[model samples]
Target: MVRILQGLAHKYFSDEEAIILLLLLVVGTGFIIFFGAMLAPAIASVIIAFILQGLVAKLRSLGVPEIVAILGVFLVFMGILVGFIFGLLPLIWTQVSALASEAPRIIRELQSYLELLPDQYPHLVSAEAVNTVYQQVSAEVGQITQWLVSFSLSSIPDLVALLIYVVLVPILVFFFLKDRRVLISSIGRLLPPQRPMMARIWHEVNLQCANYVRGKAVEILIVGSVTYVAFKLLGMPYAALLAMLVGLSVVIPYIGAAVVTIPVAVIGLFAFGWGTHFIWVMVAYGIIQALDGNVLVPILFSEVNNLHPVAIIVAVLFFGGIWGMWGVFFAIPLATMLKAVFAAWPVKTLERSPASEEE
Candidate 1:
């Protein structure tokens, strides 16, 4: 056993392990820097806007004229953006306003509930303490609203930057699509002769990313459609807006679905009143999750890059902490890339062979 342990350690440390470790370290460092660079909202927006360009490129390859595809996709995306702003925004605003109007009533109900709690446990009762808590909570809420307004005002520069991205993304995406073949050939030529393996790995990674992108699009559509119908049936105000939010939230791993449900259900309960309708909405969401997990996910999301659910969740949390919404948006793609890289490594491949794979 001692000799076997020594042999194993020596094999890992002295053989290709050292090189692989170094490559992984370098890749991690580069990713950290790349994320930091994407902190610029313009950069982030441009990157997202390129998704449309990607769709255009796909259409062009399918026999549509390049210019026509680009124009069509661009216009469709812009129209949707405009529709959301003009149509959905007002409904969302009105519903939100209604919720705000009900805040005092909810507060009073909550205080009554608290009073009941203290009355049940006389030892915990303190009239002054309860008043202080109520006052402090009210004051904190006012400050939060003020902060939100200030923050909104401060985002003017970011909005302007996003406009620049809207103009630039298409230009960049067009060039990227036009030169994609050239880029791949150039990259292939640059691969070191000793590493003929890298070309195959690159091809595999490309295939994996393509599958993931297509699957994700389907997932988003299914989620959005289901959410919209559910919200509408519930008689919830701003159903479209909530549906859009729920659909988009699915992009984030783990808690996204539940996170979206909170606001929708809370508003439904308060604005529309908590009763059969609210419960049915909850039931609908639960049914949706059951369908997603059993039916939808299996059918649409079957092309996973072999990443564990935990790894994807961790990536979402890590990136979301650093870059907030944008990080969460790109988490799956980045995680897929990491999985591809790991899969391409010789040690990982060998470790998953036959007996080792079973272990």
Candidate 2:
């Protein structure tokens, strides 16, 4: 046991730099676990700043002054933030309330239809089974109602926090972008200068993460914009809202598209009665999804490497479980970081064989 422990230590924990890297990782993990919710805005701002850093760099490369470039990027960021807050959010919120108010009527109509199922398919579905399913459905609806009531009542505190975030995040982002060099230097000073493994990991993560994040932002915008145009042309209700949902669904590989499809299809069926409009809407949506998965993603990630499908799913489930939307948003990068660390960690093989020894 002592020999095994020593061997493992020699392989993985031989250097002060390795110990420092591990300690930093542990501390960062602890910080997230302890203060994730409270510090969500700050963390979000940092990520936004990270994404916009590329834009800033590009502007600088065009011979724009650093301060001017930062200001320009920051203004664009603020414009989008304001547009979301004052325009899109309110529209989405209005539609959400409408959906909520109409939910009971929809449920009643669905129940009435379901109640006729046993009559239409007596051999397949017994009356007793229909009754049991009806009861379960009703109970689930009641649970959803209770949750909605609680959510609406509890949203006051959340609104206040959101307002605080609105005030704080821009300031943090401005400073982060403006003083990026100083911040990077300060962080670099804490690490050992000669740490090759840590430096390699940082470089790889920075390059890949930056590309991935910027590409994702572009994907979401393009997908959402195209979807909105399609839905609007089809005269669908809540076009902006559904388009946004469709856009964001790309974050989770397989599950998001599947989960969100139900609502889109239901809404279309309810509105257009499975007619040509409904068929057209669905077909267009399918095309959009296909293009995104096959075309946009491949082109965007062509420079960046692909993550394993299983790794992505596991990361989405694990981190999304922990941090909700934020976890899901950052899951790929987090998984990549782990992949890099594990790949670079020192390991040795003991491959001495009896046949080889004899030879």
Candidate 3:
């Protein structure tokens, strides 16, 4: 046991930097897990600042001065935030509330369809099975309604939090951008000076995460706008809400597309019925999804290189379960960071020779 412990110690604790890295990882993860909610605004600010750094770099590449580029990016961020708050959020909220209110009628329509299963396809589907499904659907609808009601009831507190986030995030983001070097230097001062592994991981993660976040933002806007336009042309009900779901669906892997499809199909069926219009609506939606997954995602996230789909999905589920929406949003980057760390971690290699074996 002493020999084994000695071997383990030699493998992991041979270097002071390794000890420091391990300590930092444990402490950082603990802070994130324990006080994440309390630090959400700050965390969110960091993410937003990272995203906007791409724009700053772009402006700098175009011969813009450093301060000018930062100012431009900051102004653009503020404009977008203001627009989202005043123009987009209210519309999305109204649509969401409307969707919740219409749930009962939608459930009724689904139940009505289920009722015909026994008569229409008696051999294929039994009344008992149909009724079972009907019960499940009804229960799900009730749960959804309950959640919406609870959410509405708590809107005041939520709004207050939102207001706080709105005021704090921008300030934090501005300072984060303006003093990026100073902040980085401050953080570095706390870490062991000789940290090749940590530095390598940080460099890779920073590059990948900045590209991923900025690309995701662009993808979301493009997808949402395109979907909204198409839905509007088709006269689809709740176009804005459905488009928003379609846009955000890009965050999760296959699961998001599958889940969002439920509402889109439901709304489409309710709006257009089983007609050519409904068929067209579905085709259009399918096209949007196909383009996003096959074309847009690849083009935008090419900088992410070769993240396995399974890894991405697992990250989405695991981190999302732990930290909810923020986790889901950062899942890919976090997974990438983990992968980089694992790759960068120094592993002890044993030289197996006759002399060593004899010893």
Candidate 4:
């Protein structure tokens, strides 16, 4: 057992640089695990700044001064932020309140439909099964209602935190963008000057993550706008809310789309019933998703390394479990970072067997 342990250690961590890199990763993960919530504003600021950096760079490349570029990007960001707060949010909120007020009616209608299932398919569905399913759904809806009540009652602290983020995030992001070089140099100074493996891993992770985040931002905007237009044209109720869900659903790959479909179907059924209008809504949604997956994704993410579906699902589950929504949004990039680290990680070569060497 001792020899096995020694061999394993030697094979994996023989390099001093590897040990240092591993320690850095461990410390970073531990910090996020313990203090991530407290530093969420800063983390969010960093991510926002990182995404905007590409635009800044593009402006600079077009012969704009650095300060001008920074100001331009920051102003556009602030404009969008303000517009969302003053315009889009109120619309979504109104829809949400309406939905809440209508929930009981929706549920009763759903129950009525469920109750007919046994009669409609007497041989396939029994009244007992329908009752059991309805009971479970009712319990789940009851829990959701309780949660909404509690959340509303406890939203004071959250609102305060949000205000702080609203004030602080823009400031942090501006400084992060303006002092990007200084910050990079300062962080660089803390690490060993000779860090080939670290450099390699950083290069890979940075390219992949940056591309992913920016592409996703664009994807969300395009998908959401397109969905809103389609829903509005179809006279769908809560068009903005459903459009937002459809947009954000791309973040979780397969799972998000499936989950968001429930709400879309429910809202459509409530508004248009089980008729051609409802069918049209579903058809439009299907076309949008198909275009996004086949056309938009290929163009936007041509540079990204594709993980296996199983690996992607596992990453989504693992990271989403740990960090909730943020984890779910960043699962792919996190997984990519892990992949890059493993690819560049230093390891000692083991001795080849004499029989294999002869062959």
Candidate 5:
């Protein structure tokens, strides 16, 4: 066991740089795990600044002054932020409240539909099974209601934190953008000058993560806006709310679309019943999803390395378990970072003895 352990350690961590990198990763992950909540605003600012850095670089490439480019990108970000806060947020909130008010009616309709299932499919579904299912759903809904009430009652502190983020994030993002080089240089100064392995991993991780984060942001906006327009055209209820769900559903890769389909289908059924209109609404949604998967994704993420569906799902589950929504959101990026690290990691190959080589 001792020899085996030593062999494994020598094989994987023989390089001093590898040991240093491992320690850095451990320390960084520990910091985030311990202080993530308190430093959320700063973390958010970093992500936003990272996303906006591409635009800043593009403008700089076109001979725009760095300060001007930063200001331009910053202003555009603020406009979008303000629009979302004032316009889109209220619309979504109103729809959410409206949906909540109509929930009992929807539930009743659902219960009535389920009650007929046993009769329609007597062999497949029993009355007892239907009753059990309804009970489970009702219990879940009740729990959700309780949770919402508690959350609302406790939301004052959250709102205060949100206000602080709104004020501080922009300021932090501006400085981050303005002092991007200075910050990088300062941090770089702390590390050993000879860090080829670290440099390679950072380069790959930075490129992949930046592309993913920015592309994902664009995808969500496009998918949500297109979904909203399509739902509105189909005269679907809760267009904004449904669109938001549809947009966010993309975050979970293969599972998000499948999960969100239930709500969209349910809402469409309630609004249009089992008819051509409902069919059309579903068809439109299917088309949007198809286009997003086949067209938009390829275009936006042309430079990204595509993970297998299973790997993506596993990453989502693992990271989301660790950091909740943030983990879910950055699962792909984090996974990519891990992939790059593994690819670049230094490993000393075991040397064969003369007897083994002769054999």
Candidate 6:
């Protein structure tokens, strides 16, 4: 086995030049991936600042003090956020409370459905087994609150990190917005002479992140509103909460829509007595999503990218596997950047353009 491995390694290195070239390419790709992940926070911050930086710069250019401009922008943004929270919180709270009260009934309905299945096929499952499972679930119910508290405690560090980000981002954002030219020039100085091309590529990638901020906010609100209204009309419990979840998840792209709908459909099944009515609600969700994907998103994010759906799926899974939920959240934007970069590459451009046009 060792001899065989040695022979393969020898052959691989026999062409030393090719081996070095391959290694360099591998290292370069790894560096780009690593750099992307590492700079996610700063990238997010910069994009956010860019949205308001134009206004800030305009104000300063027009004789407004930097402090006043910053304050005005911050206050305007905060007012928008506050208004949204104030409008949505009550409905969300009410639905969440209603869902908590209905949990036992939902569980009971599930138990009944399972028991009925066994009755329809006695050899498949016994009454004793069903009862045992129900009893086990009932026992676990008492531990739910304890588990939640423990989970919260375990996530203290993450909570702290989030708090740190909350505090730091605004400060970082202000400086970035105020001194954007200086910062960009400083970064350019750090790169090698030949790598100005790479720096420009990075800058272009940064510019594209605004697509996520602007596009996602609109998409999430629309999807969430549709979900809330759909659930409420269906008389599903926790309509507001479910809608919020569906809306939040919608930002994650393809899989998010399904994840948001399934539980709501299940709850609707129990609430509406398991019939065509329940099925109709699920079908409505599908229709709404289809419209959103085919009409709403395209209209809203027309220039976002035209990458294939399969590529989006691969990105979500590939990155999500590496970094968990955050990976999934960033996947689409990252994928969009990849699509834009490749499409804009010199070779692709030259191929598409006529020789006279290029010259």
The numbered model that scores best in lDDT is 5
The TM-score values for the models, in the order shown, are 0.73, 0.90, 0.91, 0.94, 0.96, 0.67
Model 6 regions more than 4 Å off = 1-44, 50-73, 80-101, 119-146, 149-162, 192-196, 199-208, 229-235, 275-280, 344-359
Lowest lDDT sum, 10 consecutive residues, model 4, at 144-153
> lDDT score, residue 21, model 4?
88
Whole-model Cα lDDT per candidate? 0.67, 0.86, 0.87, 0.91, 0.92, 0.71
Clashes of each: 0, 0, 0, 0, 0, 0
- Displacement of residue 24 (Cα, Å) in model 2 is 1.2
The lDDT, on a scale of 0 to 1, for candidate 4 is 0.91
Residue 264 error for model 3, in Å? 1.0
Over the stretch 266-359, how does candidate 2's per-residue lDDT look in tens digits? 8888778758989999999999999999999999888777788999999998998988877998898788778767766656555568999999
Which runs of model 1 end up more than 4 angstroms from their true locations? 1-75, 82-102, 113-143, 185-195, 348-359
Better of 1 and 2 by TM-score: 2
TM-score of 5: 0.96
Error of 4 at 166 (Å): 0.5
Candidate 5, residue 230: lDDT: 96
Candidate 6 per-residue lDDT, tens place, 1-359, comes to 99767665665444444344345557866774678566656766776787676567779999999889988987776665556557777677666556656667878887888789677989988888888888887667536534544755787887787666666666777677768789989966654555433545465655565655567767888988887788778776777787788888866776787787777777778878878888888887788888888998888776565558799799999878876877787788778777655443332111234866877
User: Residue-wise lDDT of candidate 5 within 1-359, one digit each (tens)?
Assistant: 99999999999999888998899999999999999999999999999999999999999999999999999999999999999999999899889777777777888899999999998999999999999998888787777666665776788898898899999999999999999999999999988999888898889888888898889899999999999999999899999999999999887788999999999999999999999999999999999999999999999999988898989999999999999988998888889888878878888999989999999
Q: What is the lDDT of candidate 5?
A: 0.92
lDDT of residue 164 for candidate 3: 98
lDDT string, candidate 3, 23-72, tens digits: 88899989999999999999999988988998898999999999999998
